[model samples]
Target: MKAIKSFSIGLIFFVVSSCGSLNPINPLSLLMGNSWALSSLMGKSLDLSQFADGVPSLNFLEGGKLAGFTGCNNLSGSFALEGSSIRLDPGAVTRKACPGTGEQDFLGALSKVGNLKIGKDKLTFLNGEEELMSFIPKED
Candidate 1:
């Protein structure tokens, strides 16, 4: 009878410990397969009407690929993430005669991104602790 009780306790403990081993949601899962639109840059809110090609946006793709628009030009790049650290490399940008300086500003900010913050509804790029750009979920 004592052996039966000990065996039962061991089985219960094993099941409880196994439940804790289940992985929690990964933060990277939040970024992948999501489209984010630029809402602010350098502490200033953007006026989407001012962009020639609508608001700038980013689509994080699988396998470390990135695709986006720079308000006037289409942007393609690669990104590497290690924990919260991020490196954004702007690869090719379509050369179109853009009116305002929004595209330039966007690219410049992208180059400066050294870290990232993912909030409940926002993605913010930062150079160290200073925010360089902020994005929101792109409307479907």
Candidate 2:
């Protein structure tokens, strides 16, 4: 029957179209709602004892909000993402009379971050092609 044949064709078209509508995994999903702890700075491993706090860490929140600890003062900022590129704007930092210049170094490096890459177990921030900092997922 013509009606049966037309129905079959329509069903096939619907199935094909539904498959096409499925979107690929979004990279933002990997970055949002995740926390990363500072692991290495400028290719050098950090000595946690140097920090008064346990370790510097970052938490990426919804709506581009950023919160972290700089090993001395609390860090707050806003971040924007475009594809794999990122821009972090450092905001208010508590005056805690940090002993060394490590906090300053961390914030300074943060300001220069131009992009980011998320790997299997690492998140890396880079300025162009040079890696500025790297982080590991904060254990919950």
State which candidate has the highest TM-score. Answer: 1
Which pairs clash (backbone N, Cα, C closer than 3 Å) in model 2? none
lDDT per residue for candidate 1 within 16-65, as digits (tens), equals 99999998655578787469999999989996655788899998888889
Looking at model 1, residue 5 earns an lDDT score of: 100
Best by lDDT: 1
Sliding window of 10 residues with minimal summed lDDT for model 1: 24-33
**Residue by residue across 1-140, what tens digits does model 2's lDDT show?**
99999999999999999998997656567776468899988778987766777789888888888889999899788899998899988688888887776787789899999999886578999999998999998998
The list of candidate 2 runs beyond 4 A from truth reads: 1-25
Predictions: Cα RMSD each: 4.0, 4.7
Measured against the true structure, the TM-scores of the candidates, in listed sequence, are 0.81, 0.79
lDDT of 2: 0.85
